[model samples]
Structures are given as C-alpha cells and as structure tokens.
Target chain A: MTAAALSLSKIVAGHDGHVSISDVTLAVPAGARVAVIGANGAGKSTLLKTIAGELPPLGGQMRRCATCARMGYLPQSATVDTRFPVSVYEFVAMGVWNHVGLFRRLGPAVRQRIDAALDRTGLAALARRPIGALSGGQLQRARFARLMLQDAALLLLDEPFAGVDRPTREALMALIDGWHAEGRTCLVVLHDLDLVRQRFEWCLSVDDGHAQLTPTAELLALRPTADGAAAARHAFLRDALRA
Target chain B: MSWLLDPFDFAFMRGALAACVALSLGAAPVGVFMLLRRMSLMGDAISHAILPGAALGYLAAGLSLGAMTLGGVAAGVLVALAAGLVARRSALREDASLAAFYLISLAIGVLLVSLKSRNIDLLHVLFGSVLSLDRDALLLIAGIATASLFGLAALYRPLVIECADPDYLRQAGGPGALVHLGFLLLAVLNLVAGFHALGTLMAVGIMVLPAASARLLCERLDSMLALAVGNALAGSIGGLLLSYHLDVPAGPAVVLSLGLIYVVVLAFTALRPRPILTSEVTA
Candidate 1:
C-alpha cells in the first residue's frame, strides 16, 4: 500500500478577511493520480497554493511526511517569470537546488540526473540552447524537464499544457503517464476534461469553496456546471452545509 | 593607452581608478541579482539612506573612510530594516516606504553636513573627487570587491533560484525567505561600498545597467554575471579616462560610460542572432 503524501483536515484558507476556501478535508494517498476541476475561482488555485505552502492555511491542521521534500509544484504560467536569461540545461539543473543548498557544487551523479531529466522530457536536443530562445511548446518541455529532476514523490501541476502545441502536449502527457507507471502520485490542475479522464485515474471536483471525491466516471457523467464555478462552489457549499 | 598611462602618474588619479574598478566589479553582480529581485529602486534607497551614518562617521572620527564607510553601511542596513518593517506593518507600498526612507535620510544628511562641512565638501560627499582619493581607499575597495566575488561565486545558484522561482523554493523547504532577505542585504552593503565613487544616484546604474545590458546578450546567469562585471569595470575605466581627458566630473562620467554601454548592447542585441527557441526565461 502507498503512503499518504498530503493530508489536510478541516482546513480553511483565505486572504483579506474573506475565506476563499474553507473546511476542506482531503487526503491524497501516495502515488494517486488526481485531477482538480471546477469553474474559475472555485478556490482551486487557492487550495493548491495553500497545499504547496506558498501560503499557510488560515485554519485547521495540515501535516505531511517529514521527508516530503520530494514534492514538486508548477505555479500558473502567469506567476512565473518566463523572461530570465537561462539556457535549457541551466534551467533544468535548478531542480536539484533543494539538495544543492548554498555553497555546494553539483556532483557528477547529479549532472547525470539532470541529463536524464532533460532526455526524459524530450528536451535533450534543446539543452544547449537558451531557455528564452525556445518556442512555447519547447519552453513547457524545458519546465517539465525540471519537474522530472525533482524526483518528487508527488507532482502538482497548474495548467502545464497551457499554450503548448499539440504534439508536444501528447509527449508531455506520455511523460506524466510514465511517472504514474513508476507509482509516483500526481495532482494535475487541468482545463481539459477529455485529457483529464484519458490521463488521470481520480477526480477532485471543486465547486464554491468545497471539493469532493467524485469518481472520475461521475464527473465525466455529470456535465460541467452551468452559471460558472464561483457560484457553483457557493451553491455546493450551501447544500453541503445543510446536509 | 595614454589615458590609462597618464592616470597612474598621479597618485590620487591612480587611487580613484583602482577603487572605482573594484567597486564596480562587485556591485555589477550584486546589481544583476538586484535587478532580478525587482529591488533596483530599493538599492537606490539604501544608498541614499546611508547618508546620515556617513555624516555621523565624519562627525566622530573626521573624514576617515573606515569610520564613514562603517557608519554608512550601518545606516543603510537600518533603513532597509525600517523599510521592510514599514512595508509589512503599514498600508504604504514598498516603493512609498523607500521614498520615505529617501526623504528622512536626506534630511538627516543635510542637517549633519550643515553642522560641520561646507557646501562644496558635501558636494564632494555626494559626488566624489578624483583629487581626494588615496591608496587606503583603493585597498578598502579592493578587499570588499574580492570578498564579494568569492561570496557570489559560492552562492550564485541558490540566489538565482531564489529570484527565479520562490514557489518551488518554498515547497522544497529551503531557506528561501532568509536567502531572499540576504540578497537584499547584499544590495545594501554593495551600495554603501559604491557610495563614494558612483554616488547614490549613479551607483544603481553602475549596479543595474551592466547587468541589464548583459541580459540582452546572454542566456545564462553565470555568463550574464561575468559579462556584467566586465562591463562595469570597462565602463568605469572608460568613464575615468574620458573624464580625465575632457575635465568632466568623474561620477557622472562613469555612469555615462555605463549608459553608453547599454545603448551599445541594445543596438548590438537587436542586430545579433537570438537562440532558436521562442521564449527564454531563467530558472
């Protein structure tokens, strides 16, 4: 049996006095592939942010394994500064920073790992080139290479496929599928339902401030909500509160 | 060559040149990180905020570089701490707090300078004199620059990663926050070190322009830092020579040289071939 990677008990998180997401309880068993889906501002990103430790939960106890350093997070495309002057190789090498710390040199094994990561992501050919010099599809590939090097037990991706071309997208999904095959857990925040089911094994549908463990089949069975997600989460929260 | 050759003939000119070279070398890489962290304005704020300390140093031990520099570094660090606190505590924005820092420091500096020195001496304080520099200043600047270089060489990756992506850094459970504040402290200390040659206003350019120009040309952080340090050294030397030959002020001259370097970088990058991929971002 796989260990649990993340467990949040009755967590409440928000900013500026208003709770964005509250009273959410979820446990992501290690190696489980889960997708979070909802309309905009269903607290999907907020929840992800809190879980990623970018922001602390406003309420509740959140606990994790002490060796949880093997966790990877890819923020939304907008939050990243895509204009830094780094080569594809240099950028991907950064995935080892947690282990590197300050004032340490990368050993040959680590270099080999970085090389393997880039190759795994289908970015080996692009290693020598400038990161800024890559096309949208190519850049995403480079970022994915970094993710691979993290050797993370769990992967959290926020819109990884955004702006990527078609062939490259397939390649990326294949790479993720490969990770899933290796028994690593992944929680991907994706926009496409077709890709979600085709690639993911579990679904976490969030509406209003609440998310549920609906089987992937059920979310696929129930169509995307009407009146958008912000309202949907509210209505869903109201119903859950009454129940 | 004569411009370089003639400067060594005079001890003060030699001292100014050596000090400027050293200060620029260290400040260049520090500036690169400063630009990456979006604290270019903060660099300026710290430089100016150190004025009262420099003034206090002069008041205590007379116009000795040792006393004044220590005082200045202390004051600059205090202002940075204050700015950090104010931005966190008050509704005022970071830039606004920096502005408050600038005003208060400037006022205190003016009051101190008025209490002792004449107006031209204060002018020399704001804008350094080629004639007043000595071998002691040169050695001090050299020591500071060398130490900064060694520190930067050791910490470049962590620093670059801190600026490039803080989210992953936090998830990775590294000391991302402390490292970030350390980077800010580096900026303050570097600015205080460069305060004499570059002055407060022009010091930031000496720190920022070379890095900015290098950014246009390079695709890697290490290479960019290397190029920036080279650019700063070359630019300051060029400024010193031109100012010496043309009889212009040295501080403005050094900055003008960096400005001209940026213009050249802009033009060259426009004409140069970029990497084949579409978007280039650092990690």
Candidate 2:
C-alpha cells in the first residue's frame, strides 16, 4: 500500500469564525493528483487553505507525513497584489526563501535555478519587467515559475488555470505533470471538468458544508460529464445569487 | 553660500539638521512600505494615536524626551494591536476600526494634554520645537534611525513576500504576522522619532509624501526606496533653509516642502505620455 502524504481526520475548516466545510476526512496518497471541485462558495478554497496551513482548521486534526513536510501554495491570481513594484525575476527568486531566507545572498546555484525556472515558464525575456506590467496569462506563468522554484513536496494550487490562455494552461499542466512524475502530491482546485476528468485520478468534492473524497473516474462515469456540467453550472449561478 | 551655511552656524540648527536627516533616512523607507501595503492613511491614524501617549508622558515627566518617546511607542503599539484585534474579530473592516480608534485616541490625547499643561506647552507638543533641539532628542532620533535601518534589512524578504502575496507567506510557514507587527513597530518608532522634529501632525508627512511621490516615477522597489529617501533629504534641507530665511515654523515648512515635491512629481507623471487606452483604438 502506498504511504499517505497527507491525512485529515474529521477536519472542520472555516474563515473568521464561520465554518465552511465540516467533517472532511481523507488520506491523500503520495503522488496522487487530486482535483478539488465545487460550486462557488462551497468551501473549496477553505479546505485547501486548511491543508496548506494558511487557515487553522476549526476542529479535527491534520498530519503531513515526513516526506511531505514542505508545502507550496499558489493562491488565486486576483488575491495577489501584482501591482506591487517587483520584477518578475525578483518575484520568482522569492521561492528560494526556504533555502536562502533572510540575509543569505542568492548564490550562483540558486540564481541558475531561478533562471531555469523563469526560462521554463517562458518568462526569461520579461525577467526584468515589473510584475504589475504582466498580462493575466504572463502573471500566472510567473506564479508557476515561482512555485517551481519553491521545490515543495506537496503543491496546493487554487484555480491555477483560471484566466490563463490555452497554451499557457497546457504549459503549466506540463509542469504539474513533471512534478507528478517525480512523485510530488498535488491538490488542484479546478473548474475545468475536462482537464480534471482527463488528468486527475481522484476527486475531493466539496458541496454545501460537506466534503467527500472519491475516485474521479467513478464519479464522472456515474454522472457523466454533460449532466454533471449542467448541474455544476446551475449550482454556480444559484450560489452566485445567494452570495 | 553664507545664506545656506548660516542655518548650521548655531548649535541648535546643526542638531535640528542632524535630527531631520536621520528621521528621513528611516521614515522614508517605512513610508514606501506603508504606501505599497496600501496603509498610507493608516500611518496618519497611527500618528494621531501616538499623541495621547506623548501627552501622558508630558503630564508625568514634564517634557522629558525619554518619557515622551517611551509613552508614544507604547500608546502607538497598543492602539495598533487593539485596532487589529477589533478588525479580525468584528464585522467592521481594518480601516474602519483604525479610523474609529484613532478618532477616539485623538480626542483623548487633546483632553489629556489640556488637563495639566497650558496652551503654549500644548502647542510645543502639537507642532514640535524643531529649532530648539537638545542633546537627548538628537541621540534618540539617531539611535532610532540606526535601529530602524537594521530592522528593515532583517525583515526585508518576509516583508516583501507579505506585501506581495500574504497568503503564500502564511502557507510557507513564514512569519507573516510577526513581520507585520515588526513593520508596524518600526513605523511607530520612526513616527516617535519624527515627532521630535515635525510634531505628530507632520511626522507622517515625512514618511508618506516622499513615498507617494516616488511611487509615481519609480517602477521598481529599490528605485522607489532610493528616490523616496532622496526626496525626503531634499525636503529636510530645503524646509530648514526656508524656515530660517522666511521666518516660518520649521515643522510645517519641512512637511510643506515634501508636499511640494509630491505635487511636482504628480504633475510630471500626469503630463508624461501614457500608453494609449484600448478603448481609444479604432479597429
């Protein structure tokens, strides 16, 4: 049996005293590409935030196995203040904070790594450009570059492909595939059913106040894509209005 | 040359110049961070919050620099923490809570000052006596400036990450809250130091105006920091000279100099050609 990278026992999560997802118990297997799916306001982010340790879970316990000690979290693009005065290279170089931290110079090896990450993300030419000047797709690519440089064991991505161009999305997906090949665990919050269906083996469905972890193939097969897509769209509109 | 050199001839003028220059060194960078965090107005609120502490210190120790500085730092930090707590726990947003607290702080501070001290002493606390800088005030300002620079250096990486993407910092187990609290403490320290020369009303002026001006012209953080500090240094010297020659109050003159620089920067950026708006392009 594969070792569990992350384990959550009857976890209850929320923000600012309001509970969003309750009794979410799951043991995410090492190397599993888990897709987190839900309607708007269904606490998808709340769950991810809890696992990433950004928000403290209101109840229950979470344990990260020894191998998955380091975690990388990519928040939604809009949540980042891209308008802050920083170059793309400088922003991406921050990923080495784990190693270089404060006071240590970004030595040659780390500089090379940052350069390689930026190059892979196709941001080499725009390295010196202010982050604020990047288009949505470019900024998303910059974020991915930073995440790559983070060299984390577990990656939690929130809507990573949202507002990104198809080509950029494909490139970023390739990066994730590379990490998956290296046996890194990824919990991705995604809205694209096709991508989730094609790429992910497991799904953590976050519905109104509840969370269920299931096999993606089984879940999609039981409902099929068309009906599931319609229901999701309906729920999105309903939740939008309620919010 | 003599007109410029004349202000430095007096020991008090020399001391005041040293104080202003040192205050700008620390305050400008703090201002740049504050502006980037979108907490520019929050500085104003915090400066007002320092008032009651300074007042209480004056009431207790009667114009002792150490007492006022200690009291100001304590009061400033308490209000900051209280406001943060209220914002986190209550429905009101951070800015709203800070606004509410600062208004109350300002009123209490004025009331406290009027209780024991006469109006003349109150004026000294409110406007500051920059022209009469003594040894202890000079040492305090210099010490704060040196400490602030080192603090900012130590906190640079976490601070930048916190400002740009706070969630990522928290997720990575970086000390985001501690960095924020530390930054606020640095800001308060700089404000307290500045109040010795510019008064509470104008202390934040040194912090914000040059930073706001720099933001218009600079596209990089390092450049912004350099430019803001440069603007502040110019403002300090120019304002001191203006006060000496024009016979105006030095504190307001210095702040007004920084403000003038801001207006000039605003005008320069406004007149410069901007990228053509997408809406203006005809297909």
Candidate 3:
C-alpha cells in the first residue's frame, strides 16, 4: 500500500478554543479522494480548515508526509472580496507566490505557466478582465486556475462547486479527476451527496461534534431513511443534552 | 501662460506648490488601498488620533518638525493598534472603536493645544501654513513621498492579496497581518506627511477624494493608481494657484479642487451612463 498522506489521531478542531469537531481519527492514504459531508454546523468546514492548517487542532495529533510541501487550499467564496480592483490574471498569478515569493521577478517562464493555468481553467479570455466582472461560475473557475498553478500535493477544496453552473461544475470536477490521476490527495467538503457518492471513494461524516470515516459505499448504505433521520436527530439531541 | 507662470515668481508659492505635489505622490496611492479596503474612514480616524500627539509634541518642543511627526506617528499607530484590539476583543466593531478612540483623542488634542497656544497658532496646526513651509518641511515632505512610494511598490502584491482575500493569503504562507500592519504604518506616515502640508483637518481629504474620483474613472488597479496620482497633482497645483490668486487657505483649496474634480467626473459618468463592469460578490 502507498504511504499515508495524512494521519490524524483523536483530533479536535475549531476556532477560538471552541471544539467544533472532536475525536476525528483517520489516515488518508496517498492519492485518496475523500469527501467530507455533514449537515450545516456539523464541522465539515472546520475539519478541512484544520487539515489545511488554517486552524489549529484544539487537541490531538496530526501528521503529513514530509514530501507534501505544497498544499493548495480553496476556501469558501465568501472569504474573497471580489470588489477589489484585480484582474483575473493577477488574481490567478498569486498562486505562484509560493515559488517566486514577493520580491522575485516573474520571468517569461512564470508568465507562460500562469497563461497555461488560465487556459486550462477556461479563463484565458477573461485574463485581462477584472475579477469583479466574472459571474459566480467564472469566479470559481478563476480560483481553480489559481489552484492549478499552485500544483499542490494535497488539495483541500471547501464547497468548490457551490453555486457554480453545470458546465463549470463538470469542468472543475474534470480538473479534480486529473489531479487524482496524478496521485494527489484530495479532501473535499461537499454538500451534494449524489456527486460525492459517485466520485469519492472515502467518506467522512461529521455530526454533533462526532466524525466517522468510512468507505463511501458503506456510508451510502448506512444513510438514514426519512424515519431513521428523524430518529437520528432525536438521538443526537439526547446525546448532546447528556454530554 | 502668465497666470500659471506668475505663481512661481514668489518663492513661498513655489514652496507651497512643491509641498502639495510631494504630499500627493505619497498619500494618493495609500488612498487607493484605503478606498479599496473600505477603510476610508480609518484615514480620518488616524488623522484625528494624531492630534493629541502633535499637541504634546508642540508642548514639548514648540514647532519642531521631528518632534511633532514622531509624536503623531506614535499616537496614530497606538490608536490604530488599540482600536484593532478593542474591535477584536469586544462587542464593538472596528469602526465604532476607532470612532470612539479618535473622538477622545481629538478632544484631548484640542484641549492641549488651547492650554499653551493662542487660537491663531492653533489654527496653523489645525490648518497647515503651506505657503510658509520652510526648507526642513519641504525636505521632510519629499523624503516621505519617496519612502512611501518605494514602500507601496515593494508591498504591492502582498497588500493586494491581503485586501482581496486575507484568509487565502494566510493559508498560502503570506504574512497577512504583517502586510496589514505595514500598510497601516504607511497610512500613518502619509497622514503625517499630509499634516505638514494640509493640516490634520484636511489631510485625509486630499488622499481620499483623488482616489475615490480615480475609482469612478478607471476599472483596473494600475489605471486607478495612475489616475489618482495625476488627479492629486493637478488638484494640488490648481489649489495652489487658486490660493495664490484668491487669498484662500491652500489646504482647503486643494481639497476643494479635488472635490470639484470628483463632482465633474461623477456628472460626466452619469451623463454618459457607462456600464459598470464590476459586480461585488455577495458574501
């Protein structure tokens, strides 16, 4: 078996010392496509944030392979202020910052790389247009173009397809498929269960501060029916009150 | 031609024009970021907060440039830090905290100025004597403009990323907080530079108006920056000429000229009905 890309032991994660997800223990193997799925406020994003190093684990241990140097993170679209006067190319070129940094010159090679990424993400034509001019789907495409430039080993995508159009969604998924084929590790936070079941091999379900990592097939089989969902909610309330 | 050429005949008018132009080069670019970040009021807040420190410096050294600038920068930075902390730690928002702090600072500054100096001297502090700018003041203004322009160029990338998407910058290993603080320091430095030429009351006006007007005129950041600098220089020169010819305060004249430009652009843009290409993403 390939070496584990990420190892988490009894991890608790959240912001400002408040635990959002507790006891999350899992080992994501190399090239694994893992979907993090949960209801609202179920700590799905919090878990991804921890894995992406945006938030510290409130408790527990986590490790990644030393080779996983470049980790690309696509935060929720709400985090970006689109009104800022930046062109699509300029916004996407920011991904090269890890390599070129602040002071280094962006030579012809770097420019070509940025152009390639923009072309791949279907944003080549909009390269000179301001980012604020792009629609929701186009904006998401621009962000993906940026991530493509990053070329990270581990990709953490938070709602990458959220609010995107069908064509854009398919294009983004194709990009992810390409990444997975390249043996990259992907931890995706997704709301569309159908898409997750079809695309992902592993599923991590978070609910009421508890997380369970299981195979996608097994989790889909165990998914609650309408009556079961209600019962589950009741049990969840009981467990919470008892805690 | 003589109407324009006549102002340079008087050395003081030339000094005033030079001072205004130098102040614009630094403050206008800083104003671009300020407008983009929706921190326009922060400039006003920092300018007001600098008053107490300027007053204290005046009390200690009596019209010494270095002493007053140091005090103003120290006070502006302190208030910015405090206001940031208060906003983060408490229920009040950043704007509210900044407003509260600046009001108290302004009151204290006015009180301190009144304690030792007459109203006329206080007026000089409140509204700068641009025409009477000495050699030291001219040097300070030029130095600040050079430093600020260099700093802005160096920090351009990180500052833009920080303003647009701070979380992404942080996650990508960019120093977001440091960029923010660096920008704040530049803002304070430029405000101090402006204070020397335009006074605390009118300094932010020259920075904000030109940038805001530039925003209406340009869609790209680079274009906006260029236009803002151009507008600032034009406004300053125009205001100097207006002040020389009409016997008005140079600082307010400069600001009013900028406002007039903005109003004209606003009217022109309205008449043409240009399609606004930018659309803000709903958070």
**What's the distance in Å from true for residue B121, model 3?**
0.9
lDDT of each: 0.77, 0.87, 0.86
lDDT by residue (B49-140, candidate 3, tens digit) is 88899899999999899999999999999988888899999999988998899799889998999999999877877887888999999999
Task: Please tell me how candidate 1 rates in CAPRI terms.
Answer: acceptable
In terms of TM-score, how similar is model 3 to the real structure? 0.94
Please list the Cα RMSD from the true structure of every candidate, rounded to 1 decimal place: 4.0, 4.2, 3.4
TM-score of chain B of each: 0.90, 0.95, 0.96
Residue-level lDDT tens digits of model 2 in B181-204: 999999999989888888888889
* Tens digits of lDDT, candidate 1, B132-166: 66667667768778877777776677777666665
The lDDT leader among the candidates is 2
Best by TM-score: 3
TM-score of 1: 0.87
Q: After superposition, how far is residue B88 of candidate 3 from its true place, in Å?
A: 1.7
The candidate 1 chain A region of ten consecutive residues with least summed lDDT is A225-234
TM-score of each: 0.87, 0.91, 0.94
lDDT agreement of model 3 with the native: 0.86
Candidate 2 on A1-243: residue-level lDDT in tens?
A: 989999999999998899998998889999999988888788999999889877899999999989788788898754568779988899898888987877799999999999999999999998998877778788888888988988988999999998777898999999999899999999999988888889999887788787776777666556464445634643553353345
Q: What tens-digit string does per-residue lDDT give for candidate 1 at A116-173?
A: 9888887888888766577778777877888888888878887788888788889998
Query: Model 1 residue A179 lDDT?
Result: 83
